[model samples]
Target: MTLEVMARCSAAAMAALAVMMAVGTDTVGQDTETVKPDERSKVSQYGIRWTFSEPRRVGRFVNGDWWVVGPATVVSVTPKPGPAPEDEVTEIKRNQFGDAAHQDDRRMRNGSMIVIKSSGRQGYDSRVKSYDPGLSVQFPRPLKPGQSLISSVSHTSLPNNNFSHKIMW
Candidate 1:
């Protein structure tokens, strides 16, 4: 065969080999398939309880599955006979977990705690206002003889299909 013809045939053979390698046919396992239900409930036995020493100004129990739009804070006090001091304020919100798709947990004073599991999203704006069993709080703190206290709990679901339950008293 002429040298040019021989070279052309060799090039064509190499091209076919490259195509075959790109479309690999190696099967690593059998074709058997099995599907399972997506069961995503985490809290099987969850509970929250709080105790106080005195009473002070109270607010409505804003209950819901809240998505954190910005930072949040919490305040707690032993409740003295006089007016509640401002020093009792406890900032809460620095203890969040995950990057754009991660989970985190946080604890706050005033008998409040939170578990944050988030898959980050830009301009995320979604919240729910309802009662859920996973987010329940029992206040045991004793108010003054005539004073009262307020407690609030919140629960939320993350973008990654995970749920969070928070309680404050």
Candidate 2:
């Protein structure tokens, strides 16, 4: 093989290796799956709550953040649904560190926020008195079996404030 040809081949091989390293492989055990909470609880690290209602969807974000989605329920309640068809609520919990910052930055840059609202009779009657991070928000009243709650968060900053006036959900 000519020296020039060998050099070109080596360069191509190196490029391929660089790309592979950039996109690392996912190890089965290394990837943690999001699991629905058996009951209503707060994830202290991220200041998010896990409300497990019917039909749970648990998985890690693309960035390896853990989250559980189910019906939004009241934390004060007891003996709630657990891995049963009868459960019909869902809440999403993101517990990974930096997830909030990344989400917040994305929302802020995009000039949008995520609003999570409640559903059913419980949501209509019960209001979210307050919300806090790393703590569960206490409800004035217990959520009914089929009720849900919703909340929203928006990004605070944008580049050049060009899209500041625009609203994003």
The TM-scores, one per candidate, come to 0.16, 0.20
- Location of the lowest summed lDDT over 10 successive residues in candidate 1: 11-20
Candidates' C-alpha lDDT = 0.21, 0.23
Q: Residue 107's C-alpha lDDT in candidate 2?
A: 8
Instruction: Give the poorly placed runs of model 2, Cα more than 4 Å off.
Output: 1-37, 43-47, 50-138, 158-169
lDDT of 1 by residue, 20-62 (tens): 0112233434784432212221101113222223222221113
Superposed on all Cα atoms, the candidates' RMSDs to the truth, in angstroms, are 28.7, 21.9
lDDT of 1: 0.21
* TM-score of predicted structure 2: 0.20
Error of 1 at 83 (Å): 29
The 10 consecutive residues of candidate 2 with the worst lDDT sum are: 11-20
